[model samples]
Target: MLEEKFERLRNFLLAYFNQDMESPEGALQEYIEENSEGAISTTLAQINTFLHEDLTEQVKEQFIEDNCDLYFPALELTPVEWLKQVQAELKSTLG
Candidate 1:
């Protein structure tokens, strides 16, 4: 199921980029707009599960620090909070 989800996302992105040659930032924005619910849900589920499992603390911290701005603009929120926000946004988008 996860593989299928990623395949769908990959196809969407390829088609998106093919239609309009956009900058990396523009592609990201378009990706979110085009696949908002799937993107958010898949990312949230993967990150949430990864965080919950036993992993290198350093790596996890580095990832959160690197992606916090991209995924969660609000710097004040914790990582878990960010995941919850993503999930909420996905639900709202799908609804």
Candidate 2:
């Protein structure tokens, strides 16, 4: 499930975000580990929570500040395009 998502995610990050794989992944993992004090809205809380300590004030503030047009990725392709890739690969196997 996740490997299929990497190209989409990487393209999104590269196009609009200041982050690369490690920085964004670290941020997300930190979000996952950090325990919240308040009743976190589910929408906000689902990003990540893997922090091991109280996050610094600045770091906590920037955790999920992902800047991307993730709703419509620039590298986005239609399902038909993906299917065509599969078809091309299968043609090699059948050769």
The clash number for model 1 is: 0
Q: Positional deviation of 53 in candidate 2, in angstroms? A: 56
- Candidate 2, residues 1-95, lDDT tens digits: the string is 22232333333334433434344334434433452323123312222221222556344223313333222233253322322332343333334
| Estimated TM-score for each candidate | 0.40, 0.22
lDDT of 1 by residue, 1-95 (tens): 33343353334334543435444346545656866575656755664565565656665555444432333343465644544554465456557
Clashes of 2: 8
Question: Would you give me the overall lDDT of model 2?
Answer: 0.33
Task: Tell me which residue pairs clash in candidate 1.
Answer: none
